[model samples]
Target: MSKDFTYTINSIFFDENYRPSDGTRITTNFANLARGESRRENLRNALRMIDSRFNALANWDNIKRDRYSVELEIISVDIDIEGNGQHFPSIEMLKTNIIDHKAHKRIEGIVGNNFSSYVRDYDFSVLLLDHNKDLGAFSVPDGFGDLHGKLFKDFIASDSYQEKFNKSPVICLSVSDNKTYYRSENYHPVLGVEYLPNESSLTEQYFKKMGFEVRYFMPPNSVAPLAFYFFGDLLSDYTNIELIGTISTMETFQKIYRPEIYNANAVAGNHYRPDLKHPDYSLTQIVYDREERSQLAIKQGKFAEEYFIKPYRSVLEHWSENSAL
Candidate 1:
């Protein structure tokens, strides 16, 4: 093996001009939405489905309490790869921007005025691990921490991100663990984890040194936890607080509507049994994992409630009441 090959992976999200880049074409939902003359209408319908699913997770029937609604935005993040000896360590984020749309209002402390989202290439993360079998768990080479730090620092300091949002954005990601993790107390499924780079976590330590706050949240009913990083006071932002709910809902939705893209095995496409020669050859499961996904949504929603919503209940209530006016 040459030990050197390079390639670019596009984000699943849309770009500034509201176009799906070359990379987004692999996914079924985005492609279907981009098809035909009714893209906007299709998008609206999809949003409605997502919103409805989110609301279902809320305790709306409670007469004494108020409810919160989440706003969703699709943005682009392009990663250009210049393959070096270790490709994952050399990948660089080139551009990132939110799609142009009427619904996208520049919320203070949420999205920047330049309308950009986070930029980093994690698509090849698994491939990197698989390729570097020689290195095994110690595959993350030197300078990886520096690269990670610079990417986040640049994103936080970027004109696109800093123009509107005064603080950092919340970062949600899957946990980096080979073993299946679960909540010790209840034995229920969790999808997130709070990662502190103490002696236990080198990745967390790298991010902590770079001024990033890391937490992991696993979806409800999931066998393991994913990592979520908070860059600023995301727990206090009413609108942004809906982020947890939004992400959990959309991911569950994908599993149902687009099983081919679902991270079913938690390794991203492992369950699909893709044949490299036949790029489109996916041995997708005939039955959707609706039960697991629904349970995940419920658990994820509750997790958000305790971690984000409940802590700031009074603030959220006040915002809800005021926004009604």
Candidate 2:
């Protein structure tokens, strides 16, 4: 571990086309910044949040001791489901790389991108056709209800997405269920570990058949449950090294800085949505009462010391030993 690793932050590697190499583990917060008031301001705030958090990581000591700086790049691609010449707005697809300045080695898996349930936001527009206007109040047609599902499936399986990463991507997403173990007193959420049983998640089953090894992880105090789709063995290398640290760090960062978005009851509204019945989407429970959901978040965060950090202690320790000079 004598060699130093250079970390680059917010650097973009893709061209105007937004296509990546094969097997690249693409990570994003799914237009988290792109959605709000000012795109520039949101991006600035997002980067600042990450920068401050990275500097706050316990492993590094000071500026002089800071061997791990990050390079981050934000990119997006447009998928035209319509054959018309009109193009949709650019989708945000970001890339991150951690470099070792001393050894000149580049680390790919340190930061995995995340996307929220926003697939419907962008792709849903494409599915809304003039012919299907009378389908329902949601404006989604009959057989086309799976339009979002099909688009998501095709995107991941598409050459554009596969080629973007040097390795298969680990797609992480959220799930909600009242009967799920996390809701039970006997069970609690843990980050970086699988949560859903194979039969429980439709999204998980879909990805698994597409050659992805699906594993789910939900952080303590997390508003929604998450599923991690490992395209190959990508999770193994990442978890053994930077993945744990990154997840924990982001957990703390979001709670402190983005409480409204990251809080435990944050996703309660999703349960009641009419779209939940769509086959293209995973099933979820609507928790209308704030009190119950808040209690769940509290309990979820309570066992952090016992369940998450402690269990992954060795992985964190191992990463610390090898990631530094």
Off by over 4 Å in 2: 1-45, 51-65, 80-91, 101-106, 110-112, 116-119, 122-153, 157-159, 174-179, 183-214, 218-226, 237-325
TM-score of each: 0.45, 0.46
lDDT of each: 0.38, 0.40
Q: Ten-residue segment with the worst summed lDDT in candidate 1?
A: 112-121
Model 1: lDDT to the true structure: 0.38
Candidate 1 structure, TM-score to reference: 0.45
lDDT of 2 by residue, 175-219 (tens): 433225232222322342344442454444444444557554544
Backbone clashes, candidate 2? 36
Tens-digit per-residue lDDT, 1-325, candidate 1: 1112222332333321244444332222333354446656555555454444444444345233224333444434332222432212122121112121333443222331111212112212332334467764555544444434544454455454455345555544434433223333322122232223223355566656446666544344332344555566544543423443535444443444444333344432111222223233233222333344334433433443444334544643453344311
